[model samples]
Target: MAPHPPQSRPSTGPDPSAIDTSRRPFVLIWEVTQACDLACDHCRADAHPARHPDELTTSEGKHLLDQAREFGPGQLVVLSGGDPLTRPDLVELIEYGTSRGLRMTLTPSGTSSLTPETVHRLSDAGVTRLAVSLDGATPDTHDTFRGESGSFEQTVRAARAARDAGLPVQINTTVCAQTVDELPALRDLVDELGAVLWSVFFLVPIGRGRVLEPITPDRAETVMQWLSEVSDDAPFGVKTTEAPFYRRVAIQHRRDANETPTDDDIGRRLGITAGDGFAFVSHTGELYPSGFLPESAGTVRDGGLVERYRESELFQSLRDRDALRGKCGACEFRHVCGGSRSRAYAHTGDPLASDPLCAYVPDGYSGPLPEGRVSGD
Candidate 1:
């Protein structure tokens, strides 16, 4: 008479549209090679000269492209590497991505001068844009960070070459404690180079960067303030993603002043966030949910790209609240910020832990937040 009824469980089967939904991935990053010429201090890609089978061949790359195309039209593909330019087959790979309705882009170290012939090939291959990494304002600082002499010269040359080739060029700099004091010079450099946009990302402590503390709270604020001031007079538009609150306010201020300038307009118009507009594929063909996250969802060689991502628990978890831990649940800015999963894992040694970087934000800033608590688990 006291026997209890059986408990029931809810269905958790996969949704058919989960892979092909347009609302999900707006862009994808394919790391064709981890073989790089220069060794940067803060690089998380671990891109040193090493013998690894992660580099994709022409057929393999095309197979990945075919899988990516299943996400539907207008998805952007970023061809990255330890240095993507080092690959001789880069042009053909870019062509393959573009031919599949993926707008192709690349991120290069700028260690070697991009040959005019190569630039022409890239143009013919339909490479839409190129982003060159520039971590410091002056030659001494910039070249030093890259761990090579004369890198600044080569980078500047490459930037000019990309621009002259009719490919839009964007400069990406990491705002660390070392470079925090040089915001003005950085802006000037952007202007001098005729860059389309200046993207400043916070230095995430991961990989080789784990040993160093990037910046303190006070220093981060100082850098933010300086960037705000410099961007006011900048001819080229400035945009930042990692530093969300400060950059959001800065962009709004400029927009309110009737400034029509914008960065990643295609992404903006499409309502794509930094992570959504891009997915980083490792050299071994394992597709990550985003560039920085360590969780490998699946490999491109597994099968059709769309089917693999669809079956990925890690990929799905990225967009789902159940996958988050601790403060991310209640974070006020969870939607806009999405928080940095990779950053959380690296700093605290917990993938689901709250981002330690939040400690840098000032106390009085008004904004939405995700879960404001953290866990050691």
Candidate 2:
């Protein structure tokens, strides 16, 4: 095997030309607040309801909206939080982003205290998609992970409300050892909900999620296999069987049909661009390169939106020649993997660790498996 890519420090200073306006912009999951009503066991953000008052002020949030708009069309603007609906200013943020031609999604704990009027307001605010976390098919498993007794009921109710409002609902499930066995049942529930998509997030063992429960490699593999099966058969517009493993299936699907997804498709399909890709805007108004990790660039408050694009370390690193090469060059799965830096950091405490979840079968480990050949033999 090729030697592992050399470890190098990320460049600290920003370069003005670093912002790749030439390439379509990334999807921005602007985390409006970290104050969430539910304390899910697997949440990497360590969100809680009491923290909202201390997060981004109303002015800071508006600046973030402006920065997101600079990315232009085909970008997604996801308003997330401990629960976005908890923010009184959510409508303004959503409206501001949508006015800039951004497609948007609102991620709530489903305990957003969203009345029917508020739900319709979100749709009017340009939230075309809605994603609610449903870790298990039933309350026993789900509520346990969410750390709330009635979370399942709340999430289900919110999803139904979103659907009834004509917004496409996607169930976001975080697969862990505790919930792995019930994946099939979860998929069945998605179908019953009439939801349009399912995004399965493998437990990354970060923050409170790690403190609660973690998945074994074997369980991760099991979840990946389950997701692939569901993706093949699922009717959702965006169906990723695996968490980070979505790339492989997406590549084949995009190839076999000879369909080329535009920037919007790329962002939403890969969870990268605006409303779709993995993203997180911090309470300080700094953008983590992605939502799954808590790393940051400078605060949007200290600088204009352009300053973030030009100077933020995360953006700079993502665009750096040496950095992207280090990640993109090694591994047989490069073309399909497109490793997410934030996930890498959250899982291994290093932005560059080989993803632990990537299946690594020994060359001669084949036993009773199909064709009597090992995965890497």
Candidate 3:
């Protein structure tokens, strides 16, 4: 028998990007553990079976929470890792962070640890949101990417459990050459799971991810075009991670359609790039511009996070679009879409290099490649 086609619907909530967060970093990604049971092909943490002995202690975690309050009160602190659920003290950490007036989110690798009881417990512990990774639509595709059999089934079960427990779920999908073709099917799956948000993370090669081939610049642009169309009719808010250029693409699309673009839309696009309104603290407390951009600014143990982020050379470089090398520095959309530093760094060793995955030739770009422009992998 033929199955019924999935129905298209509009998102009930406001655009996820429109949610007002202060210009300062209003969110922090804390990798609380580096241990995982699965060896996914594109794992940024290069996770292993055993937990790191030097991973942040419970006392240190509480202290980091204290520092986070000073950095941005009521900030959204995301508890992530190879799999945050691998840590026995995850709930305790969540409770502590919540008690400190921080909104908390959890990202657990879909594995045996994400049981039904675990979902309810996380909801009870004041986790406002739960994000699970779903790279592919089908079991064979997804499980193969995750490097574990039945991972797709387990992730589905976990997502359903989280939704049924009244916890909002966001499905994070990694978009790469290998997975791009499956986005339509993944979208249908997202709708079926009733996910509130579908976050498409463009590949940033680092750690184990270095081996995976990222989609070409032209392909990324095409995917963004498709995403711009999808977001308009999808029942859930759609967002792109590490692909800030989507904002520029959206603005151009709106302009081409003769629709008026709002200031909020522009502000939202310009406000949230890698080091500007985002920061990451590794499992060992080293701070970086973002989880994907692994150049360390300083350790949380060295000084206050706010000070380090504001004062670090890398952060400063990332914030100043004029400092970018190659066509990115000259792009008209440079401010709104400075391109992905992590991607730039992944392809070239310099984090300040232009994002190789951006195909858009800036207005006034000359014939030959600009001086100091680094070639991509």
Candidate 4:
């Protein structure tokens, strides 16, 4: 593990982190395929049983990886999918990205395809991490959520295999009304599985995810507070997806605890929401600010990936927090904890609108509050 070369950040105004979104993104997720073995209840992809006929060819995928490398050395290239294993050339793609000096990560669905051999092959191919979803502590709850029996057992086995293969594992959990109560249990499992990180994803209503119930703002605040506590004691790091307000809650908690925050405070508090420091390329080359956000800024078929991210009007608007509406625009923490752009789009049609999942209301606000905003004066 040689230390990664420092990213050549041009300027640091999102200063505490020194990650300049204008030049390159911190993460670029490419949905390699929309094909999957299970129909999970909260799947943002609404995946199908087979890959699309118009999916990017292997050469096209390599080209996309090359474009992603322009972000600079150590750029994270996540090969996400409905199930990347469904593709025959997954290892080939992984090896290509590794050769480009990009830190490649894979998020394959839990299934028979995630065999020990496959895990080892991916590790040998230079995958930086293996992210697997485990929504429940018990088999019944997890299998049901995945809409497939035996998925729970399979997922656990794959995680252990990843660990055995000497690859770092990241446990991903879906947090919503259905699974919120299981957070404490999930944390134990994350530790048992030797995961280095627990990525808690709060559900945004979309695709197959629309049917799942979102947690109310007040409840969300409580969960984040608990998570902040969990982060302090848990051996593995905890981070929220689609819930940037967790950073606000964590920061507040630190102050209340009389703890001095680190310069990399916003590192795990990554909220570089859609089109800001995050970008997603769908299986068909459609470019989105996030996998949870369906709005297309441009297609890879039309122009360069980096060009679209830096120049598109949609990306430009999303990156501009001053142009935000409601509490998000007025909040002093807008630069670092600008709220979840994907959640905002899920609530209101406008991506620039306020994220409804956050309980915080800036003082002296006089605009229409988000639907289901915490009840208070």
lDDT, residue 285, candidate 4 = 97
- The total of clashing pairs for model 1 equals 15
Instruction: Sort by lDDT, best first.
Output: 4, 3, 1, 2
What lDDT is reached at residue 327 by model 4? 86
lDDT of 2 at 228: 56
Residue 68, candidate 2: alpha-carbon lDDT: 63
- Across 87-167, the per-residue lDDT of candidate 1 in tens digits comes to 877777777777677777788776754655555567667777778878877789999888988888878887888788766
Ranking by TM-score: 4, 3, 1, 2
TM-score of each: 0.79, 0.77, 0.89, 0.92
For every model in order, what is the number of clashing pairs?
15, 15, 0, 0
Worst 10 residues of 3 by lDDT: 4-13
Q: For model 2, how does the per-residue alpha-carbon lDDT over 1-377 read when each residue is reduced to its tens digit?
A: 55322222111212222434324344466777777778787777788666655577777776666666566444666677777777787777776666655676788775637655566667766777888888888989888878888888878887887889777888898776788777789888998888988877766656776664656555565555556556667777444422444554454444542344332222343323211223456776765666666666656665555556555565655543234333233433343354555555765576644445545332343332222224553
Give one digit per residue, the lDDT tens place, for model 4 in 138-247.
Answer: 99989989988988888899999999977889999999889988888999999999999999999999999999998888899999999988888888888888888888
**lDDT tens readout by residue for model 3, 204-279:** 9888887888887778888998988888788888888888888878788667523444432422435467787788
lDDT top scorer: 4
